[model samples]
Target: MRLKRKVAMALTSVVAIGALSACGSTPSKTPAASGPKKLQIFSWWTGVASSKALNSLIGVFNKKYPGIKVINEAVAGGAGSNAKAVLASRMEANNPPGTFQVHAGGGTLLSWINAGYMAPLNSLYKQQGWYQDFPKSLLKMLTVKGNIYAVPVDMQRSNVLWYNPAIFKKYNLTPPTTFSQFFADAKVLKAHNITPLAVANHGNWETTLLYSDVLLGTLGPTQYENLLTGKAGTSWTSPGVVQATKTFLKMMQYANTDYSALHWQQADQMVAQGKAAMNVMGDWAQGYFTTALNLKPGTGFGWAATPGSQGTFAMVSDVFGLPAKLSNKTATKDFLKVLGSKAGQDTFNPLKGTFSPRLDANTSLYDAYSRSAMASFKKDQLVLVIGQGAANPGFTQAFENDMVTLLSSKNATAFTTAVESAAQSNPL
Candidate 1:
């Protein structure tokens, strides 16, 4: 559930510059001889659960490739905002890491691929027999033209509502399935002096994440996908978008007062401590709840699809790509091989609070919430996550900035107009 950035312009600029350098030379493809090689792996996974999950994956790699030294270059920021910035600098300077984490979709990875910073992994996919392992829908995201660019490890549901079961039980409330029911529950919670929702906007992308769920909830999966994909009949200024914006503003009314001051972990903390009744977030909060807060899945916390978004799965996946000009191509591919393997995915995703993207994953290894998520992922119509990797970087940046404005202005029409304008310029 590592969302993305607010520094859209800087990232855009860096990619443009990197593209120039990328054109000047072709990267080396030869594998270095296997002797104590050091492979630098870069990512934005420094949270307690994510770190543990990464370390476990590294441990697995260490066991198999004992000769290769894995360098963990993790940077901390909500949704990889800080790390993406640093990675952009490194990529622009032509000093790429052996491999790096990226959200798998047009918004994030496509930029790197288009700029020639990433090498196509079609050969690796064929070599590992991964064409049948990962779901076709997921592999579609990793593909540009005819070449697959990265290996996906885990799949996360972005449109989930995590709640304090005790709070719901105390108020005799069921998890809301529709926005009206959600409002009703909010009324009860607020009347009881309990914050109805826990929100965090420290990175400026969380609100946009909330709004993305609202859009899916309001527009339904069909029109929501149409709007995001810029279907001929759809527009960001559609009535559904307006209503969703208004709904987002209304939902904000029940949020904690200090939302701007907290990160996502703290916001999840509010629900864990019973300071808030519900939180609309990706399933990564499950990791925080189970690992950091030491809470159980069913009794300690509860979950449901975000109101009005029952059948749709808003997906965000974490992937690692082979960067061009790597000094240790053999070591990087070894890591990617492990990353895409069934055993490796199983080992990492459970601890990461996500489900493996592999269609044949062992569901028994996952927890209650993760198993439920995996089921939805298999059957539900999947939509890429906004502010994560649904749209291009330019549009994502604009969407986040407009969400910040909408927070203070509470003007749904103006926000829709701004977003629509951005979509026009950025081509969705």
Candidate 2:
């Protein structure tokens, strides 16, 4: 389905920037004002709870680094789809924000790294001693070759299934652990006039997220990771992926009719308000539920890995990377140091519903869902979430378009062909 809000705005400046940069001349921004200037930070976490969580962290940052004004310029849309386009326009104009959100994985990072628009944060890592603080596995995703390029803000588990516990109790149901169990429960819920799945077809990124869970559940860990990273040469066209697409199609059948018209949060609200039983969304929904809606973790809401994805953690990191064209590198780097610190992440992640990317973050500050995610992060088979992982951004768009096509037609053969072709055309 096509997105409701304009998701992909045509960034003509990107094309112009490409042409101009090829000619060895790119526009230079007029330098920052003579006095202390505002460190304009760009991001997409503009929702009520996420905004409060970030603003709280900004409060702390201001206390630590006085005389610097921290301006949060967030343009909201799922997975930074809208913000990324806006960011590309600004960066290409050589009017980069001091720092902006980017997926820590190659899916979002490789293009920026390859374009040489990012600064190498290796020296910052060494200077701040962050190598010992963050998880090495996550660091690996954030790294290109031997250099780390971003300061990770938080970690989100993409395959989490958030459901209304009261709705489950009323339906005499427990969280399903497999697809068959899920379908069995879905039939009962549907008969009882409850929408079994909460999904948003108004946006493609959320659809990609929803399908990615079903994809992970069907393909399992090793093959799923391989396929996402382009390590599995033959699996792209395999029956396994087609089966996953089929499962995704079946899951879509039980969704609300207005699912196509609703945004991801509206779809999620169907579950939260007891109009639906479950939602296939990321753990960021946790923040919305707990902080915004004031729902408790174990009592009001519950979380489980998407069916058949137990022992696997499909995740993405929200990170801030420095642009090479910043007019305020000094203030930006100082803020980055705050982002990398334990105090900073601890203050942010609890309310944001993400765990700290750092191994040493205080777990006592985390709730039940976050604590469980942290444990799974350590022991589970971790895979970079394909929607936000290491693939080219164009490839992500192609994948999302194909996913929407597959959902509508339910043609496994065509879906596989389209995805395989997209991957071939846009390799990481």
lDDT of each: 0.89, 0.83
Off by over 4 Å in 1: 1-35
Per-residue lDDT for 1-428 in model 2, tens only? Answer: 24533343335666677887866644655565776667888999898667988998898899998889999999987557789889889878888888988887877677888898999899999988999877787788888889889999888888889888998898899899999999999999999998999888787678888877888888888888778778846556798988888888888888876766888778778888999999988887887787668888888888899999999988788888888867568889989998888889999888777889788878899888889999998778777776777478888888878877777788988988988999889875
On TM-score, the candidate that comes out on top is 1
Candidate 1 lDDT (Cα, 0 to 1) = 0.89
lDDT of 1 by residue, 242-316 (tens): 998889899999999788898988999999999999998888888888888899999999999999999898899
Poorest stretch of ten by lDDT in candidate 1: 25-34
Instruction: Supply the global lDDT for candidate 2.
Output: 0.83
Tell me the lDDT of model 2 at 355: 85
- TM-score, each model? 0.88, 0.87
Q: What is the lDDT of residue 417 in candidate 2?
A: 93
By summed lDDT, the worst window of 10 consecutive residues in model 2 runs over: 1-10
Clash count for candidate 1 is 0
